[model samples]
Target chain A: MMRNLFERTGEKTLGFLQRLGRASIFLFHVLKGFPIVLTRPKLLLDSLYSVGVLSLLIIVFSALFVGMVISLLGYVTLVDFGAEQSLGVLVALSILRELAPVLTALLYSGRAGSALTAEIGLMKATEQLASIEMMAIDPIRRVITPRFVAGIIAVPLLTLMFMVVGIYSGYLIGHGWLGVDEGSFWAQMQSKVQWNYDILNGLLKGFIFGIAVNWIALFEGYDAVPTSEGVARATTRSVVYSALIVLALDFILTSIMFVEV
Target chain B: MTQAYIEIKDLTFARGQRQIFDGINLEIPQGAITAVMGPSGCGKTTLLRHIGGQLQADSGSVSVAGVQMNGLSRSELFALRKQMGMLFQSGALLTDLNVFENVAFPVREHYQFDESMVRDIVLMKLEIVGLRGAAQLMPSELSGGMARRVALARAIVLDPALMMYDEPFTGLDPITLGNIVTLIRSLSKSLGITSILVSHDINESLSIADYLCVLAEGKVVAQGPVEVVKATASPWLKQFLTGSTEGPVDFHYPATSRANDFHLEAKS
Candidate 1:
């Protein structure tokens, strides 16, 4: 039993290493094709519309609800210590530093990331990729690099938008709804939330998460087995892998930025 | 026979354990239609991939227009590919683009042609395939045969010297099938382009092909002019040509015997 277990584990480890090697090569090709994609601006713009603009509604709605809930929780907790005025700091810091970038990435993975996987997977299954190859056009440059650039551009932008909307909704709850002192709330938030320490770090995290999520998504699609079921599985894996990578990268980035090492 | 435009010699390839092609040799004459017919899972499509330089041979070489496909650089292979065109079985049109844009794709990819020139070339190719009127329709809106015609239009848009049709007649209605067969014949003759058609549609292919090759068990079973293919003495070839189930070709995949699998005793 122990031998079988070790054998299976070893095989799995080898498979994973093989996949990692392939993904690294795919990334290299995508980066190499980046300049070629720039010459075709319309491809990038279309990808932005799909990956970023279309995802606006869900991001805004989720941000508002999350912001309100965080404010409510923070107010109730702080009221016990007569520090209810600090509700703004709690909500603003959480949204700007943690919630905005992480939640935006998770949602982006579910929405744009899965869609990208499905689209590219279907393209492969239907032999569109092969057709492009037969035409002597590299599908990586023609198809993948534009979407990668667009995702990197979109995720950070979406994270920033999420932060703004989340903070605004937090203000609405803390001052307008919960009846906290509006002047003290704004003052505390402004004093507490350092631009470089919190906001810039969050955007930096978003940037890294953007690269991770898009890389996972595109690689999954490109490496997918060419079939209907393969595409479906690839789409699922894209979202799941993106979510995991986003969360894991969040922890590492947070430790590096916020922790006193 | 004319000088060979595409040559395959001692080519062998495998996917993991199962060898798909074993020492297969072929010579496709310049500016003639060569139909490669084989059973399902018999590597007809794999042969096309070899000829197109998408898949490399294990033991031998594939040469297209005198250029060895194996060791050429990516740019060189791509440059070679520009002189070749392949119509995939699924039509494989870019779903996002309309038929006009799909047909214009190859031209637009290679050259900075004026819109008028692109449109003129695209429309002219579409007219040949009788899809000029359907240019504005999306791939999703197209019928299977319409999509195939559009793919063919795209394949020929660059005026390639070599054209490959991979199962060009599969999944088409008889009328559509006839149209495609006619198109394949006329295009090869009119443009004087060498053609390699990989298909199982024996009658349709034989109707259009000048030369015929029948592949079985990773080897060419029979190959000659269309006239001689009908009178081959090989029982395997005869059975295949006639579409008979009773032949050397097994109806079932290799597996345990039914009685053994079900644990039934043999009848005395």
Candidate 2:
């Protein structure tokens, strides 16, 4: 039984390594298609419209509620120390440094990423990809790369949007609803939130999460089993895997960027 | 006899444990319609893929138009594929695009023609397939036969030297099937292109085919003209052509005797 356990572990490790290698190769091919995709601007624009524009309402809606809750909770807690004036600092710092980038990525993966997986998976299932190949066109270049570039570009922009809306909503709750001083709220947030440390790093984190999410989504679709059930499973895996990767990357990025040496 | 356009020799392939093709040898003639027929799951589509260079042989050669498929570089293979067209079993039209755009796809990919020229070429192909009026319709709006015709227009848009059809007659009404049969016959004659059709509709294929090839057990068991194949002495070939259950191809699943399977005592 002990030997069997070791053997199983070894086999699982090898299988994981094989998949990792294939995924890396897939990324390479996708990157190589970048030049071709750039020459055709319409493809990129269409992808942006689907993945970025269509996702705007959800991001804004979710960010507003999250920011309000954080502001409300921060106000109640800081009142104990009579330090309720620092509510802006708490709200701005949390939204910029953590919540905006992470939540936007999670939402993007659930919405745009899953749709991408299902679309590509259905294309494969229906032999559209093979037909593209028989037409002497590379499906990777024509289909996958545009969406990949769009996702990467869209995430950082969405994160910035999320940050703006979140901070503003926090202001509405802290000053408008609650009895916080407006001057202290703006003053404390401006003083505490550094552009380089908080905002720039957050955007960078968003960019990295974009790559992870799109990579997983595209690979899952392209490598799917090409059936209705297969596409469904791939869509689920794309969202689930991307959410996990985003959270894990958040922890690692926070440790590196925010942790004082 | 016409010169061979596609030649497969000693082709062998297996998917994990199931060997799909085993030492199969066949030749498709140039500018002629060759029908490849076999029972379901007997690798008719697999043979077409092999010829199209979509699937590589295990230890053999698949040469199309004198170029060995396995030996071409990626760019070289793609260059070759430009002169080849394949209609998938599902019609495989880009669902996102309308009928006009689907037919125009290959032309757009290969060249930078003016909008007018592209429009003219697309309309011409759609006209040939009797779908000119349906150009603005989406794939989802099309019937199965209409979708297949649109896919056929797309396949032939580039005027390829060779065309492959994978089960093109499947899942069609009798009228649509008859229309497809006539369209394929006329297309082959007018285009003067080598055509290989993979289908289970024996009568439809034999109606248009200049040659017939039947595959079973990973080999070509019968191959000749339509009349020759019709008069074949091979029981498996006869069984397949006539759609009879009694033949070497068993109707029952391979298992122990029924009594043994039921756990009954053996009769002495």
Candidate 3:
């Protein structure tokens, strides 16, 4: 049993190494296709539409609900402590620092990232990549680069939307519904929130999350074994990895930014 | 004799531990159709991959139009590939792109021609494949044969010197296959382009192939002009051509085989 366990561990390690190698190869192709992003503006624009415009409703709804719930909870607790005015500040910081970008990434990973992986995975399975190479169209440029660029551009914009809807919903809950004065809410926000730092951190998290989601999705799609089961596995793996990496990076960034010295 | 447009010398390929091709030497003469036919897993697709530079040979060289394909950079290979076109088995048309965009893909990717030029060329190529009216339709909207024609149109859009078709007749109705075979012949003749077809459709391939190569067990079991290959006395070739189950190609499972064991277990 011990020997079997060690052998299983060794096999798992080798599998991870193989995946890492395939990821690097895919990354090379993606970087090589950067010129395509500039040249194929239509493809990039269409991808932006798919990744951003299509995702707007879901991101907005998720943010609104999350922010509303958090603010409502915070208001109840703070009112009991006679510190109800801190709800605005608490909601703003939560949305900007954590909820907006991470949750938005999770949603993007499920919708856009999984779709991207499935699309590319099917292409790979069907030998479209080989066909592209035969036609002298670099698959990296023609297929991956546009999607990558679109993801990078779209994720941040989606995160911005998430932050906006989240803050608006939080304000609605804390001020209009809960009867906290609008003056104290804005004052609390102004006193506690640093726009530059908060926005920068949000954007940074958005950018990193975008890269992680795209990289994982593209890598899974590109290296997917050419079978129905392989495609299913790749799609699942892309979503799971993207979500995990987004949450992990959120924690790392938060710790670096807010941890007490 | 016309110069051989694509010359593959001693080409060998291995996928993981499996050797797909070994010391396979073949040449595609300019302005003719050369067909590589074999049973499934006999490395016909791998050979096409080598010729298209999609798969690097384990050993040997692939030279296309006097350009050595072995050491060429990806960009250089891309340039060579731009001069060639490939039709995949499933047609491999991008589902997201409409027929017009799929046909226009190559022209737009490699060249800096204006939209009008690209549009004119795309339309011309589509017309050649008799798919001009189907330009706006998505690949999913087209029938299998129509999709293959669109793929062929996309392949030839750039006016490539060499066109490679991988299993062009697979899964097509008889009428569609006949049309495709005629298209393969006429396109190569009309454009003065070299064509290489890798297929399992032996009879159709024999009818269209100026030169025929039969591969088995990673080696060419028979090769030459169609008549010569037809006249050859190889048991594998005979069995394959006649679709016979009684010869060297065995379909029956042995009693002691793992497949047999699995079947018995499933039955029980």
* Highest-scoring model, DockQ: 2
Tens-digit lDDT string for candidate 1 (B51-167): 888998898999999999999899999999999999999999999999999999989989999999999999999999998999999999999999999999999999999999999
> Of 1 and 3, which scores higher on DockQ?
1
Give me the iRMSD of candidate 2, please.
Answer: 0.5
Worst 10 residues of 1 chain B by lDDT: B224-233
Cα-based lDDT at residue A97, candidate 3? 87
Interface RMSD list for the candidates: 0.4, 0.5, 1.0
Ranking by DockQ: 2, 1, 3
Which residue runs of candidate 3 sit more than 4 Å off their true CA positions?
B1-3, B257-268
Chain B TM-scores across candidates: 0.94, 0.95, 0.90
- Runs of candidate 2 with Cα error greater than 4 angstroms are B262-268
**Docking model 3 quality class:** high
Full-model lDDT, candidate 1: 0.93
Assess every candidate by TM-score: 0.97, 0.97, 0.93
User: What lDDT tens digits, residue by residue, belong to model 2 across residues A90-139?
Assistant: 99999999999999999999999999999999999999999999999999
Over all chains combined, what TM-score does candidate 1 have?
A: 0.97
Each candidate: RMSD to true structure? 1.8, 1.5, 3.2
